[model samples]
Target: MSPTLLVMLIMMAVPVAMVFVYSTLSNVVMERDPEFVGIENYLTLFGDEIFRKALGQTAIFTVTSVTLHLLIGLGFAMMLNSGLLPRLAAALFRVIYILPWVFTASIVVILWQLLLNPNGVINYLLEAASLIDSKVEWFSNPSLALGTVIFINVWAGYPFIMISLLAGLQGIPGDLYEAAEIDGAGWRARFFNITIPQLFPILLAVAMLDFIWNLQQFPIIWLATGGGPLNATETIATFTYNLAFSKHEFAMASASGVVLFVVSAIVALFYVRHQKARD
Candidate 1:
């Protein structure tokens, strides 16, 4: 095997095995000795209200962010593919759209922090448009923080989806669309019938992968809100970090990590089966 593949395999496997072992015992980082306590961490996790909230938040975050990624990405891809602009212009927009994605996640979070401040340009634009009478607290308000994180995630992630769908769109034979037009089909009919059907397989694959990524998204949400304002924006990834490093609940953190691994594995298994059926 290639060195790169060997490295990747080791990287993926070792941490999971270590974390699973740590979950069944108390290993407070390097601060203390390891204690082998069976399933005590799981019991603590089950009774922890914060963990429950984080789990629910993760589900909401993953589903909403992934859905928006698909819809907005599809919209941009279709717009670019609509023949409304020249190839050069479309290509330029693609480059511009992916600019946010080119930066490290921490940098992207910091940039958005600047933009989403109460007195920031986003609120200024809103006020100029008379959309609101006052500044909106993007990260400080508990009610709005989770949705704000999801919105930022969508902004950072949609370009990848857009480019992927664009590739799939360009792969479609023009004759199929031309034939549909010749049969007197409206654009809506063509999109619903031809475009959707042809893209369904790719759509499922992208959706599954995107869901997995969003489920464990860490830096963006953490840097933006630090799972703050009463842990409103907390997801599993942030929850694990806060537990392991911040609070020094290493055993519980390892259990949370193990749970994430199991949940992700289950989702990936389903995705693999669905993809196989498509083939």
Candidate 2:
């Protein structure tokens, strides 16, 4: 316990404390005599147009990704758990659906890059089907880059929710459904009254956790578009990365990182509270 606690403090607490302290100072990591600017960094961040844009885009990305992940995951989970399909077919589909989750972000991004390229299979199919006359630059077009990245994120993320929800769905007693059927409840009614109620706790927990994960997603976006196409897909994670490494504004980046931390912390508090209530 002592060794584990020591490792935790060294690995997590020290870095967090350093970032928080750096967020309050100016010229950190770039200058020997950094000034203590207090909250000036945060003030400047909020006033900066790029930061504001990144903040808003981050919100949109996180919300859209989480919502789609939940919806798609729920749909797939229900299908897999419905027992309508044969066991072998269900197992095969489960493997296919969960395959995306097994790939690393780098691999996922590269795969999408190839598929979404101007002369790629996607555009070729669309062109062949007469869906479009010109090649679509999925990641290079400002209007579509954000949505494209969101789609990639959804593609990669839904499996987590699907697997978890499937487990939760299976744990539900068959007797509950039998009782609902005995009462002459239809599919919608049974799903709404029994399935939803039974799965609400798991849903809440996963949704909040997924929100946090997607809110800080960086690698896929960075690798796919580099938050490019005129900054259309710039998220807080990428913005902070650019600030720290690209621009060498360590203090400002630290402030941005702290902001992200605060937001995630708030969500985490809600998650903890919900778990307490559920328990």
Instruction: Compare the candidates by TM-score and give the number of the best one.
Output: 2
- Cα error of candidate 2 at position 12, Å: 1.3
For all predicted structures, in order, the TM-scores are 0.93, 0.98
Clashing pairs in 2: none
Instruction: List per-prediction Cα lDDT, in the order shown.
Output: 0.90, 0.96
Best by lDDT: 2
Q: Across residues 152-258, which tens digit of lDDT does each residue of candidate 2 receive?
A: 99999999999999999999999999999999999999999999999999999999999999999999999999998889999999999999999999999999999
C-alpha root-mean-square deviation, each candidate? 1.9, 1.0
TM-score of 2: 0.98
- Residues 211-278 of candidate 1 have per-residue lDDT tens digits of 88898899999899999889899888999999888988888899999999899998899899988998
Residue ranges of candidate 1 with Cα displaced over 4 Å: 2-8, 28-33, 275-279
